[model samples]
Target: MRELTHVDENGVKMVEVGHKGEVFRKAIAKGRIHLRPETIELIRAGKTKKGNVIAAAQIAGILAVKKTPELIPLCHPILLTGVDLTFEFGEDYIEATCEVRAVYKTGVEMEALTGVSVALLTIWDMVKAVEKDESGQYPVTRIENIHVVEKVKAQVQ
Candidate 1:
């Protein structure tokens, strides 16, 4: 069995903590989530009726990076050196990539992940009017493939 770290008062496992040193000082996470076919079409046609989905999502992603500390507990509030969010339009999906850079002791993987999640949420929100099915269900909402792509420790001269 894998070692567990978080324990309750009764010594029951509540969470699992991995190796301490294994955590990267600087890390990058790349994620690719899909949007529904109808939503994609609406985005391509610029006919969401709410606003520009890509632009709104892009802005939301950037803002999410800046507010990562507030959203995630235990995340150090570091000044991000850079944040880049790009959306690749596909026939049946949308690929979102968020790159976040910070010169801090802890990595910014959470920030990048949060950025992508918020961006996708924003897109869903903006296009809900068109994406909703006859029964008012959001059948096309989904998120997938969040992984680290790069990590580099800051140099101390």
Candidate 2:
């Protein structure tokens, strides 16, 4: 096992990447939000009260990628070259995939993961009215499987 980079004798500290060479970094993350079939139909039909669910979620994902540093402590602010968010619908769920690309000294996996999380949350928020049960609880609605699916770092040429 490797030592934790965020900690040292001085206690927790941000990992310094200034000495590292810049590289082309990319990360892809995915997550899913489970909802009622009726809720999925509403989203598919563009009848959600909060406007377009997929559109709002896509924008939210991109914004989340840009704001990852502010949301996650100890994360370094990075200039992103690209961000992409996509959605695939199942019978009772929506799967979100977020991809982030940058040329920097460190990885962008956190940003990609953050993007997918927020996107899933946005979808849930947009459709919560239909997903809630009579007791005003989300009986079957849930978010899960948030993870970084891929990461690549190549030397900048």
Candidate 3:
């Protein structure tokens, strides 16, 4: 198996990317939050008590991408060129897709992943009041299938 870059015989260390040339990098991640049909309707109808769920989640996702390095240990702070977060609706779910772009020595897959996760979590938070059951538990609400769908990098020049 390949050796781990973050850990070595000495101890955990951030990977040195300064020696590598800058490259155009992009990453896409997607995730979904399952909710009650009624909760979905409330969100669609703009009747949620917390306000516009999609807009709030989109902003949260982009912010999450920019703050990824601060949140995740060992991540290099990257200069992101662009970030886009979009959402789609299903019968009982909302799907979030996050794309991050950068010109840097390292990839932005973690940033994309972070964006999607926070977006979904924001949705969950906004609609939790309606999603919880009599026991105050989220029986049918869940965040699922959070993952990086793509990662690409090429020479910047």
Runs of candidate 2 exceeding 4 Å displacement: none
Question: For model 2, what is the error of residue 122's alpha carbon versus the real structure, in angstroms, after optimal superposition?
Answer: 0.7
In candidate 2, the residue pairs with backbone N, CA or C atoms under 3 Å apart (3 or more residues apart, or in different chains) clash, namely none
Poorest 10 consecutive residues of model 2 by lDDT?
124-133
14-130 in candidate 3: lDDT tens per residue? 999999999999999999999999999999999999999999999999999999999999999999999999999998999999999999999999999999999999999999999
TM-score for every candidate vs. truth? 0.77, 0.98, 0.98
What's the TM for model 1?
0.77
Model 2: lDDT equals: 0.95
Clash number for each model: 0, 0, 0
Q: How high is the CA lDDT of each candidate model? A: 0.75, 0.95, 0.95
Error of 3 at 112 (Å): 0.4
Residues 60-129, candidate 1: write the lDDT tens digits.
9999989987997656687788888888888767778888876655678888888888888887788777
Deviating ranges (above 4 Å) for candidate 3: none
Q: What does candidate 2's lDDT look like per residue over 1-157, in tens digits?
A: 8899998999999999999999999999999999988899999999999999999999999999999999999999999999999999999999999999999999999999999999999998888888888899999999999999999999877
Measured with C-alpha atoms, the lDDT of residue 95 in candidate 2 is 97
Residue-pair clash count for candidate 2: 0
